[model samples]
Target: MIRTLPLLLAVLASPALAQGLTDLDEVDRQVSAFVGQPTPPVDRRLRLARCTAPLALDWYGNGRQAVQVRCPVPAGWTLYVAMPAAAAAAAAPPLVQRGDSVTIQVGGDGWAVSQPGEALEAGAAGAWIKVRGLVPKAPVLRGRVLRPGLVGVDLP
Candidate 1:
């Protein structure tokens, strides 16, 4: 028993054994409650870190058809869980149409730049679509539709 106590203590002290992954069941429950319906199970493949703080949930997209689950800093992780198909189908209609003139804006830190561009495909607000600058030989880029005549490009 004395020898076994040391082995037990070492096992308990191990970081891998001490910190557990966040529970997927809890996520499903919270999401289900928010949407007023049963949500499909969160993918186990996500393997999110355990959160010490209370999880925060909010609508992710402009259409409010997806939930953004966040584990506040310390864990500092976020996951986007899409609502059921019926909810998605009820989202707002397309705002930008193919070949429409648009302002493509890319911003970071303290600086932002915008240029005239043309939409390559139609998209609703918050949807990603292909766009190209009006300048000759301008490369096609993909950006999110922010509203009519505006798209925001994310920088890597």
Candidate 2:
């Protein structure tokens, strides 16, 4: 029994080490409150890597209908939680106008880049829009509108 003690500890710790797990019901409640909308039920059979800390949920690709739940610790994985497909297809109107100065942010791994850009057209939170950077000759980049002046980009 003594010889196997270390092995037992390792086994118990493996799930948390490999990835973090979150309470689906709790997550749904928090997400719903944040968006002011009901979230789709997560399949109970789906297993997620456990997180050591609380999960941070936010709009992932466009910040419109999809929400991303991320582990706060290093090497923790990010899960993309989507809103109902029906609601996504019927999204809302543009939240911003053309020529509007907006904030742009793209994140990957554990780092994010934040900059300012001008909107090339009107778009809603999930709608894609062309954003012109401040640097000279910088090509217009496409990003999703997050809010009034905020946009979120999916990083590779």
Candidate 3:
């Protein structure tokens, strides 16, 4: 029992605890604006280091719908904020939904090929997702979700 006291003290004195805790509501508000959609409630067990300086929220990674919260201050920390799985699936805007028929346009330099395709994933406007081209043997392509039945692919 005595040996565990040092471990407990170390945890209590950690930088994360010293920085204080962030409010989940504030995190939701910022993430919602970034994603261009209303986010459902965050998990009750989610807690992050308080950011006294400006807080920057960015997408977690490619193909991930989560947000990364970071504090720019020295000795700052980062936290990943992901919406509840069920909420994410239900929150997609009406403009695009999973398995919807959409047009995939692949082009660059003012020229492109537009093909009829199917949306492989549900996404909001301006969100990038997988789309299956109609042509046989065609590979699934990534395109930005535009509107109903519309997806746009940008060529390099």
lDDT winner: 1
**lDDT of candidate 1 over 1-156, digit per residue (tens):** 999999999977855456677878899999888776776778877777888898898877785668899998763899999877566534457889999999999999999999999999988777789999999999999999998999999987
Per-residue lDDT of candidate 3, residues 37-145 (tens digit): 7876667586566878978877653334567778888888787777655444444454667788899987778687888888888887667789998888888888887
Candidate 3 residue-wise lDDT at 23: 70
- What is residue 10's positional error in candidate 1, in angstroms? 52
**Model 2 alpha-carbon miss at residue 110, Å:** 32
Q: Which stretches of candidate 1 lie over 4 Å from their true place?
A: 1-60, 67-90
Q: In model 3, which regions exceed 4 Å deviation?
A: 1-19, 83-156
Q: In candidate 2, what are the lDDT values of residues 14-92, reduced to their tens digit?
A: 6533455566677778777755677776666656666678878776555356777788899887766687754553445
After best superposition, candidate 3 residue 131: deviation in angstroms? 7.7
Clashing pairs in 3: none
Instruction: Give the Cα-based TM-score of candidate 2 against the true structure.
Output: 0.45
Better of 1 and 2 by lDDT: 1
TM-score of each: 0.49, 0.45, 0.42
How far off is residue 57 in model 1, in Å? 16
Error of 1 at 22 (Å): 27
